[model samples]
Target: MNITLKPTPEIILTGDRATGPLHLGHYVGSLKQRVFLQSQHEQTILVADMQGLTDNAHNPAKVSSNILNVVADYLAVGINTEQTTICLQSQLPALAELTMYYSNLVSIARLERNPTVKAEIQSKGFERAIPAGFLTYPISQAADITAFNATLIPVGDDQLPMLEQTNEIVRKINHLANKKVLNECRPLLSNAPRLPSTDGKNKMSKTMGNTINLGASEKEISAAVKAMYTDPNHLRVQDPGQVEGNIVFTYLDAFHSDKDYVEQLKSQYRRGGLGDGTTKKILEECLQSLLGPIRNKRAEYLNDKAQLMAILKQGSQAAKEKTEKTLFDVKAVFGLNIL
Candidate 1:
């Protein structure tokens, strides 16, 4: 509901933690939209390695191994590096410095109050021994946004509280530091909210074993598509089906080209005439059409590992310049500037 009206060519901060390869949920939920925004906004796609290390500290190799995989996933999904700055979060020192300052602006209790954090904690099953870094991630995210002076943050509705918390930190820091160093960020909500997995059990996630990777081969995607959940009530071909809760239809609505045809199919399905196999075949074809090119592109990048890292390094350097300048101004305000 809170849409940006005059949509200026402002900076945007959006990315995923490089803990694993991105999946379809990641595409529909954010990355696909980010691909379009890259042309319109001054976008920065962060591979949040620092954040990834918070929970994955014990498995540093997992974090290290997935960075390129994540980059591959981005490129595979048509995210142009020339238009969007793709930077590794752990490589940015300014972000760390900014996080240190922001930590003072927020209370421990406030971090506990963040709904996003609460949900993450429960999902991760970290009830008692929550890591300090994990608990303070919202502040670190605030630092990431403010360090880049990012005005637009593309996130899902579940992360609205995170945007609110970041703005609150911005206001608090600006007043406390006696300088308006941080800019308030607006949430560019994904048109598709949280996408459910093929299993229809929970949100599509890497850990849930229900995701179809963005770079999956056509054959692999077909196998996954065949197992996708549909209307349970419509057990047989002649049973009246429901499209409202069908994930197959949801994917079609999100990705398919022929919307009218899909709508007609849904109507027929509900009228107890259409077969589930027929509908699934349509869904499979739609998905294959979308994913085939992405798989090819990912294969190309995976073959040339050095070239991929070069692009990442180049983008990281460019992003560092912007963050360094912002960190300098923030430090100057706090009188932490050594020279």
Candidate 2:
């Protein structure tokens, strides 16, 4: 009798670049999912300092300095270190080797054609001066996902293309080996709406200075909420407000935790009685309440950088074992595992 064993079904891999602190955008989209998924799945969060440098190579300090900041944000958002492994990308040797090996399996044209990489290249105006590392980071990303045999990747719609590219590499590698040497991962799409920048014109981003950081102070939170874009046409309290692009209302919908109350506010505003000041005040209170504890916890974690590093070290050590095994398996398939 012959039997077949199935691969693990729900290992998770997700993380942020070490460029800056996490903001409300992170919380609403990915962090919340990480908090929930950590308990249910085998999860690993990579502080991708290496990927961060693909763009910030000139500012290496930015990446190195924020590695722990990113980890602290993970902890601040309720990702328990014991349940979810949090490791720095630069500390993982196997990921780099896997990337080098996988690069042969991906073409530069395919890399350039990736929608996410293309959009980022155009946004950064790298027109002709695109860094080799920037273009190839998707391969590194594939290495990241497959190293741990991650089967469910948490990502937004814009990131779906990257996952497609990852599976493409997995298929190519498996086909070359003529067996199921690697597991193809799937995207755990976030149902949460994308949080816009406080300016309301773009998505929330740390580089744009238009996001509310998870660790923002009370004063900063108030100022950001007050400065949020609302209906420009509704200049007076008597004028009917447009809720569609109103940043405050959008935020209220995302975080106020009371759908009925938010709907009531929207109805009142559209009927021409609600004022922006009143609306902004409601949103500010919700934000202050939401972020106050996260800010405190983040500060507490940052105070003891030694402990943060220790946590990362422990995660990286465990991650190294998984990634190294994957690397060896791949090399064995290619007949290069002689040593």
Candidate number of the best TM-score: 2
Candidate 1 similarity to native, TM-score: 0.95
Q: Which pairs of residues collide in model 2?
A: none
For model 1, the superposed segments whose C-alpha errors exceed 4 Å read: 1-7
lDDT of 1: 0.87
What residue runs in model 2 are displaced by over 4 Å at the alpha carbon? Answer: 1-9
lDDT of 2 by residue, 1-339 (tens): 887775454899999989888899889989998998888789999999999999999989998988888888999989998799998888889899989989998998999899989999999999779999999998999999999999999999998998998999999989999999999998989999888899988756766779999989999999998889999999999889999989999899989999999999999999999999999999999999999999999999999999999999999999999999999988887899887
Tens digits of lDDT, candidate 1, 208-299: 66888888878878888788888878888888989987988888888888889988998998998898789889989888888888888888
TM-scores for all candidates: the values are 0.95, 0.96
Give the candidate number with the greatest lDDT: 2
Model 1 clashing residue pairs (backbone): none
Error of 2 at 244 (Å): 0.5
